[model samples]
Target: MAKADNIFNIRGRLGDFIFCQRNGKTYVKRYSGGFTKAATQNHPNIKVGQERFAQVSRYVKSLKQQLQPYLWRQKDGTFHNQLMALFLQIAKNETEKTFNELIHELDSYSSLSNKSLNKNSKIDPSTLLYDAKTNKLNLGIIPYELAVKYKDMYLEVATGWYGVDGEDILLSKPNIQYIKLDKQTKNEDVIVDITPAEESQTQLPFVALAVVYTDDKGSESPHLVHTVMACFVKMRNI
Candidate 1:
């Protein structure tokens, strides 16, 4: 798919092309329609590839929906396709690493946001404390020095607890907080209570932080915002 910049802002289908919207931008892609059963049977590789891609796409969609609040208007039109490609790469060598192992590796890096402020915003592993009795997870506190450096911006912190139960991906409503990035702003510990509906309470916790810039009048600036995945902890029974 390619970014479309037409003045009319077209969407839907027209002949062999399909136009769509993502992140408030238009994108166009070729749509060749479908193939018959005989066509698919003659080319087994094509059929297998289609099934694999469909499975990965479903997983990506579920994860995307879980992180919708964090995504906001932060990504470009190509983000969806780019994410799909990344997951495809992870699924390439199934023999070397189990699918679950590959999924767990996502904790090692930021899958969605850029890593520009990763070094500064990263949470210490020791600070990510989970208490089974309270059913709460402590995601750590922001450094005063970092807040002082970007006093003009707003700090947005988000933490999520994720788990996989068979085909279903269990996700708790993300705990989010926004703090005024003033030097005098009190740096409190970021904590979240995860009370999932499912019986299995095991989950892997992930945290992300974003800096949002705005003018004196309190109007937000889209181009000046930056986000990063701060930390992700190992799976445990919470």
Candidate 2:
């Protein structure tokens, strides 16, 4: 016959604890902790060391959630522009490269495109493309009024692309309107009531808000899209 010993002891400092188990002739350290003390202490019969394990598990889960958006953005073009700037130093001497080759290289370097980023979102790219193609191209170096108008349309499409419902994703207050008094003088003001939707509980989760504009002609040139994703929220109202 074998004697059975079942005793669990927790030994540690105020902020931490360790669990030890005694089984007949042998003693074993069961768990260590920093995060799981509350959840573990809730169930006493479980091994001393086991409670802390749950805390570590939960921490890892939280970390993964936090990193998900960043990981997705990285696959897009968030860092590509910086890398391209650095690559310019090395490629400066390689002028012998064909134009098509350079284009291919740049495309390969940044595999992410705005379209790919918004593929799962609610906005449709075809509409934006049509607007860009049909709109008269202003040859001026600076963005013209029409260009800004088109940019606004693009932003609306991008907002809708996220597929979030309601007016949760709103253009920042006061749509900016620029008026030119002369060649060098311009005035800017906010436009109101452009969108009638109010901030409400039923509003879709606002993943991001953006302001996009262009400095070049309405070609396939890069346009800025300020994107924001919903993660943190203030607890005042809800």
- Quantify all predictions' global Cα lDDT against the true fold: 0.57, 0.28
TM-score of 1: 0.51
Best by lDDT: 1
In model 2, the runs with Cα more than 4 Å from the true position are: 1-187, 198-238
Write down the RMSD of all candidates, one decimal each. 15.1, 20.7
lDDT tens per residue, model 1, 121-194: 23234445555566666544453434655666765566666667666666666576665666443446656565
Extract clashing residue pairs from model 2. 31-49, 121-161, 122-161, 122-163, 123-160, 123-161, 207-229, 207-230, 208-228
Candidate 2 lDDT tens digits, 65-122: 4334322332334433433333343234444553223332323223222232333222
Clash count list over all predictions: 0, 9
Weakest 10 consecutive residues of candidate 1 by summed lDDT: 112-121
Please give the distance, in angstroms, between residue 220's alpha carbon in candidate 1 and its true position after superposition.
Answer: 4.4
* lDDT, model 2, position 185: 13
